[model samples]
Target: MTDVRILGTGAYVPERVVSNDEVAAAAGVDDAWITAKTGIRERRWAAGDQATSDLAAAAGRAALRSAGLTAEDLSVIVVATSTPDRPQPPTAAYVQQRLGATGAAAFDVNAVCSGTVFALSAAEGVLGRTGGHALVIGADVYSRILNRADRRTVILFGDGAGAVVLGASGGQGPRVRHVALHSFGDLSGLIEVPAGGSRMPVDETVLDEGLQYFTMDGRGVRDFVGDHLPRLVKGFLHDCGVTPDDIAHFVPHQANGVMLDSVFAGLDLPRATMHRTLTHYGNTGAASLPITLDSAARAGAFTPGDLILMAGFGGGMAAGFALVEW
Candidate 1:
C-alpha cells in the first residue's frame, strides 16, 4: 500500500484580538474568572468582511507555499467546518475558487470539532489511490454563530483556520499510519445550536429564544470526555501497534484548558509532550488540532522517527484519532 504523508501545514487566525476583558464584560463575568475557568487570555475574531472560506484560503495558500506546490497541483480540497459562509454552498467550494484549485474536487465535512482528523482521513484515502496532492482544511467562524452575552459558549470559542497538504509519501515530513473515528448520536444533545435546521427552522420565536446561538451542557460534555477520551486513546494506540510511550507528541482539540488538563492526566502518556494553543486561541472548533500542529511544526518541534498522536473530540459528541510517524 502506498503511504500518504503531510507535505506541509499552515494556520491562520484573524487579526482582531478579543481579550478576556472584552468577553468577560459581555458575559457578565470578570477576567480573572474567565482565565481561571478556561485558561484563555484572548482569542481572535474575524473581521466584518472575512468569512470561513477566506481564512481557509489563506491557510491553504500558506500550506501550498510550505509544500512548494501550487493550487493547480491539487486533486482534492476538503474543508471541515461547522460555521460555513452560507447554508447553500459548501465552504470548500468558495475556498477552492479563492485558491484557484480548479482541478481539485471540493467538498465540506461537518464533524464539528473533530473535523480536522476526519478531513485528513478522507484526504489521505483519496491521495493514496489517486497519487496526487490534496488540501485539507479545518475552519470555523464561531463568532458569527455565537451569542455575545452567553458566557457558557461565547467565551470559549474563537475564529481561525488550519490546513495541510498531503501527497504520496516521499520519506519527508510525517507519514500517516492510522486513523479512527467514532460518533455517539445518543449524546448529540449535549452540545447544539437549537434552531436554523429543518427540525427547527429559524422563526421569530426561535430568534427570541436565542435558539440559533451555540449552547452546551458544560458538565455533560466534561463527563463525556472524562468517560470516553482515555479509553479511546488507549484503544487507538493499541490498534496502531504502538504504546503510549512511543508517542513523542500529542495534540488534542483545544476545548477547555481545565478539561484538557484532566484528560491529559488520565491518558498516562508520560513521554508525550502535549501541545496546546488554546491559551492564545481558545477553542477554535474544527481548526484547533491542525492549528496547533502547524504551530508546533513551524517551531521546529518534530524530529525524524517521532510518533505524533492527534485526537479531536467535540459537539457531534464525536471523536477522531490519527497516528502520524514523523
Candidate 2:
C-alpha cells in the first residue's frame, strides 16, 4: 500500500475583520456577552466581491507554492464546502479553473464541517492509487448565508479557506497514519440551512420566513458534541494503536472556545497542546481544522517525530479524525 502524506498546508481568511462589537450589534447582544459565551473576539467576513471559490483558489495556490508544485502537478482537487458558489456545478470546478489545474480531476464533498477530513480521506485514497499529488481544500463563506439577527449562528461563523497538498511519502513532513469518519444521520436536524435545497427550494415564502439562513439548535449541538466527541476520540486513538498521552498536538474544529475547553478536558490528553485559531477566526465550518493546522505548521509547533491529532465535528451530525505522524 502506498503511503500518502501531507506535503504542505495553507490558509486564507478574508481581509475584512468583523469585530465582536459589530457582530454583537447585529445579533442584538453585547461584546462581553458574546465573548463570555463563545470566546470569539473577532472574525473575518468576505468582501462583497469574494466568494468561496476565490478563497479556495488562493489557499490552493499557497499550498501548491508551499509544496514547490504547480497546479499542473495536481492529479486531483477536492473542495469540502457547504456554502458553495452555486448548487449546480460543484465548487471544485470553479476552484480547478481558477487554479488552472486542468489535468486534475475535481469534485466537492459536503460533509458539512466534517467535510475537511472526509475530503482528506477521499483525496488520500485517490492518491494512493494514482501516484501523484492532490489538493484538498476546505472553504466556506458563511457570512453570506448567516442571518445577522440570529445570535445562535451569526456570531459563531466566519469566511475562510484552508488547503493541503498530499502526495506519496517523501520521507519528510507528516504522514497520515489513520483517518476515521462517522455520521449520525439521526441527529441531522441539529444544524442546517433549511431552504434552497431540493426539498425546500428557495422562493418568496422562504425568503420571508428567513428559511434560507443558517440555523442550529445550539443546545442540541452542544449536547451532541458532549455525548459523542470524547468517545469517538478515544476509539480513534485506540484504533490507531496510540493513547491520549502519545499525542503531542491536538487541532480540532474551531467551533466554540467554551465548548472546546469542555471537550478537551473530557478527552484526557494531558500531554497534548490544544491549538486554536477561533479566538479571531470564529468557527469557519470545514475550514477550521485545516486553517488551524496551517497556522500551527507555520509557527514551527511540531517536531519531526511528533504525533498530531486532528478532529472535526459539525452538522450532518458528523465527526472525522485523522492521526498524523509529524
Candidate 3:
C-alpha cells in the first residue's frame, strides 16, 4: 500500500485587516466585547475583486514551492470552500486556471468548517491511487456571505486560505497515518446560509429577509462540540496507538476561542500541545486547520517524527480528525 504524506503547507490571508473596533461598530458592540466573547482581535477580509479561488491559488503556489513542485506536477486539485467565484463552475476550476495546474481533476468540498479535512481525505485517496502529488486547498471568502450588522455571526468569521501538498511518501514531512470523519446531518440547521441554494433560490424575498447571509446557532454549536470533540480526539488517538499526551501538536479548527476552551476543558490533554491562530484570524471556516498548521510549521514548532493531530468541527454539523506522523 502506498503511504500518503503531506510534503508542504502554505497559507494566505487578505491584506485588508478589519479590527474588532471596526466590526464592532457595524455590529453595534464594543471592541472589548467582541474580544472577550470570541478572543478575536482582528481578521482579514478579501477585497471585492478577490474570490475563494484567488486565495486558493496563492496558497497553492506557496505550497508547491515549499514542496519543490509546480502546478504541472499535480495530479489533482481539491478545494474546500463554502464561498466560490460563482455557483455554476466549481471553485477548483478557477483555482486551476490561476495556478496553471492544467489537466488535474478539480472540484470543491462543502463540509463548512470541516472542509479542508474533507479535501485532504480526497487528495489522500487520489494520491494513494495515482502515486502523484495532489494540492488540497481550503479557501473561503466568508466576509462576502456574512451579514455585517449581525453581531452573533459577523463577529466570528474572516476570509483566508491554506493548502497542503500530499503525495506518495518519499520519507518527507508528515505521513498521513489516519483520517476519521463524521457528520450529524440532523444538526445541519445549527449553522447555515438559509437561502441561495436550489431549495431556497435567491430572490427579492430572500434578499429582503437577509436569507443569503450566513447564520449560526452559537450556543448549539458550542454544546455539540463540547459533547463530541473530546471523545473524537480520544478515539483518534486510541486508534493511532497513543494517548492524549502522545501527539506533539494538536491543530484544531479555529472556530472560536471560547468554544475551543470549552471543548478542551473536558479532554485530558497536555496544555502545551495545542496550537491556535484564531485570536488573529477568527473562525476561518475550512481554512482554519491548514492555516494554523502552516503557521506552526513556519514558526519552527514541528520536528520530524513528532505526532500531529488535526481535528475540525462545524456545519453538516461535521467533525473529523487526521493524525499525522511528522
Candidate 1 lDDT by residue in tens digits, 119-228: 98888778878889999999999999899998998889999999999997556778989999999999999999889889999999999988998999999999999999
How would you order the candidates by lDDT, starting with the best?
2, 1, 3
lDDT top scorer: 2
Candidate 3 lDDT over 52-106, as tens digits, reads 8999999999899988998999989999998888997999999999989897889
Ranking by TM-score: 2, 1, 3
- Deviation in angstroms for 51 in model 3? 0.5
Give the whole-model CA lDDT for all candidates, comma-separated.
Answer: 0.93, 0.94, 0.89
Off by over 4 Å in 3: none
Q: In candidate 2, what are the lDDT values of residues 163-272, reduced to their tens digit?
A: 99998755677899999999999999999999998999999999999999999999999999999999999999999999999999999999999999999999999999
lDDT of 1 at 188: 99
What lDDT is obtained when candidate 3 is compared to the true structure? 0.89
Off by over 4 Å in 1: none
Write down the worst ten-residue block by lDDT for model 1: 167-176
RMSD of each: 0.9, 0.8, 1.1
